[model samples]
Target: MKKLLLATLLLLGIVTTASAQLPKVMLKSIDGKSVSTDTLSNNGKPFIIDFFATWCKPCNRELTAISEVYEEWQEETGVKVIAVSIDQAQNINKVKPLVDNHGWQYEVLLDPNSDFKRALGIQTIPYVIVCDGNGKIVSKHNGYTEGAEEELIEEVRKLVNK
Candidate 1:
């Protein structure tokens, strides 16, 4: 029990510190435009930055699950979800089609070289970072499972209320 509490605190500290500053890295748009990831702000609205790839089944599942309730989530907390594709350069071409075909409504950005991933120390897809309105990371989790997005929603609620 103590170990679990300690780990939770450690995770909270990680997010609190890391969310203060957005990383300066360029991400590609579907129109072949280079966008600085740091400029991807929510204008004082908390948001979730999800690192995913075109081929990751779990990542797709998580995003799909969140998408189902995203409208309500946004209405309640004023939060947005930013989809960051860490697909390699070779597979980068698939991102736009996948997002469009799936009808995902979030801001989709491409990280062909995974520079943002490396800078954020994200070693895996389906990684989630919840950031506050000021761009301070409040919570983070790796991987996804059923009911996981519920915990994420709670995190956003906490920060939005703060």
Candidate 2:
């Protein structure tokens, strides 16, 4: 009986891990448009999905860093970025102002309930996922540092060219 229980638990773990590797689930854009993870993939461009919050300092730092090189990154790799805010209902209103103030050129989406974040197992802000043109999650990074966005840009270029 113990062995059977252990086997069952192992199977469940495997299933959960496999599901996490899948592409982004459906989510609503801040503008109220219905957007799906598949939509970005079908756009035939590599994209970055940044799971963040308005109050997260690291998230803001990552965005600021990315903003510095975003224009050139776009020109070089034709990659688009989508910043997904995981702020709860009360804080949702802050997303636009924050993005605008930072002058971030990336697309923004709302994940108030963190549906996408939970699906991707994102437990912290500044979590980044890179998706290929086919909507597959190619790579993911957690947290951020001074030059992390540059590494992210490099990942975007690599995926876009793949």
Candidate 3:
């Protein structure tokens, strides 16, 4: 009985953890290019998807943090970061300008309809999702602080090595 109970508990934990992971959803780039989440996975590289908003200060901070280390990350892990703007249609115009002004090199996508966001159950800006080469979501962060991108880089390294 004791062994059975322990096994059941372990199984439950695994199930809950798996369900908490993010799901793949389609997204459109600012240039109107469509990309399925599946394409990002199984592509022989890990991908990072950053959910952001033009007006969110934390989102800007998150981008800035990543930008500082982006080059090194590329050189080391070849990881690709895609920034998805969840700005509403009214504020969507700011997406391009914001990216240009900040000199962010990551692919920028617009989610004006919030399809991807809703699918992922994202409720706030500055959310991040990391996927392995198989396109499976490995980790995610809800917000950022100073040096948060460094932690993200570490996770990318782990995923790449796997």
Candidate 4:
């Protein structure tokens, strides 16, 4: 019984700490600036890391939905969204134009080689990771629906209200 308890405790610890923070990976922003994934933050406020691709229609929809109400979310909870593009290095040129076309105001980063995405073990586009003020990952969401952006804000609100 004692051995089983110890094993369970060990598994719990690993599971809890495995993804507690962002994994360090070298990526670039759409503006051609090198960014370390570990350093993404929002002045001690909760932030969302959204993984996307220039080719994914659903990803585009999700980001567009968020962009529409992003301002209000910031005013209410001081939350920020960081959009990470998983487009290949050659297609990096496409990201900024898309962002501008959609008038998205989020901080956009490029994960050309997918180092950041692979580090997070993300197998799909439109994955969202929510982190608290301290940079600890608080929640994760996979896939998207028409109204899912609202759910994302509620997650951020929970952190801010804590």
Candidate 5:
């Protein structure tokens, strides 16, 4: 228990202090297109990177909430969402079906080996990373709560207002 608490604190500290460029890692889109993490952008507009898995309920709820308002958000702010699924390699086949069932329109990326997640020091599912127009990570949230998506859009709104 002590070790777990210590690790949690350490990860929290890392998350708070994280403000770096996205690492270069090649991942496959849900439709099998190759994409590089370093190139994720929204034409100089802010974007969000949400890490999740098929088995995480909180992740699903958070994403579903975002999906509901994604169109409006895009029209208002030009903010794009990149949903990264950290399901294991064997479970890769589950991602597309789950995404389709939820009707999530966000760009879905497959991180079968968690290379992208580990590169960002993420230790939990439902992790969210908000990036500025320049592709620099500006904000990160580690868990989901009701209405948290509102807070996320607020963050992007700030960048747009700048």
Candidate 6:
């Protein structure tokens, strides 16, 4: 029974590790500066990476809701939010304006080529990935509803306690 339990636990560890891996890919910042997941440092802070497009309404709503409590979230958990725009070349130019207009306090990145999106196997927009201090994604939630930010808060809290 002990050996069986050990094996099951080992398998669960492997599965969790695989699911939390984030690819190291280069992307452009809202200011046109180059940024990469490899260099995404937050002083050992938990953060959320959200993939959205300018035209994605749910994405807009999610950002809006998150923005409402973002400052509080940061103060509580030292968590940060990174908004990655999956806008194609045609709509890429609008990303900065949209971000600025909303005054969202997040590090916005432009994934115009969708390379980051493709690497993650993302099928839709408004995808949220919560990562730990070491950049390991601890939780993933697809789509958004009214209270999705609360769900994200739970994940971020887990990271904080760890």
Tens digit of per-residue lDDT, candidate 1, span 1-162: 999999999988776666566789987777778889777778898889999998999999999999999999989998899999999989988998989888889988888888999988788879998887877666679999998999999988887776
The better candidate by TM-score, 2 or 3, is 3
Stretches of candidate 1 above 4 Å error? 1-19
Pick the TM-score winner. 4
Please give the lDDT score for candidate 6: 0.88
lDDT of 6 at 31: 87
Across residues 1-162, which tens digit of lDDT does each residue of candidate 2 receive? 999999999998766543344445777777788887555643777778888899999999988888888889888887888899989989988999898898888888888888878877778778988776665676778999898887887777777665
Please give the CA lDDT of all the candidate structures.
0.87, 0.80, 0.83, 0.91, 0.95, 0.88
What is the per-residue lDDT of model 3 for residues 103-144, given as tens digits with 9 covering 90 to 100?
999898888889888887778778998877766676768988
Best-first order by lDDT: 5, 4, 6, 1, 3, 2
Q: Per-residue lDDT of 16-75 in model 4, one digit per residue for the tens?
A: 753599989988778888988898899999999999998999999999999999999999
TM-score of every candidate: 0.87, 0.81, 0.84, 0.90, 0.89, 0.88
Which portions of model 6 show Cα errors greater than 4 Å?
1-14, 17-19
Kindly give the stretch of ten consecutive residues in candidate 1 with the minimal lDDT sum.
13-22
Indicate which candidate wins on lDDT: 5
Overall local distance difference test of candidate 3: 0.83
Query: Which is the winner by lDDT between candidate 4 and candidate 5?
Result: 5
Ranking by TM-score: 4, 5, 6, 1, 3, 2
lDDT of 6 by residue, 56-98 (tens): 9999999999999999998899999999999998998899889
Residue 15 CA displacement from its true place in model 3, Å: 5.5
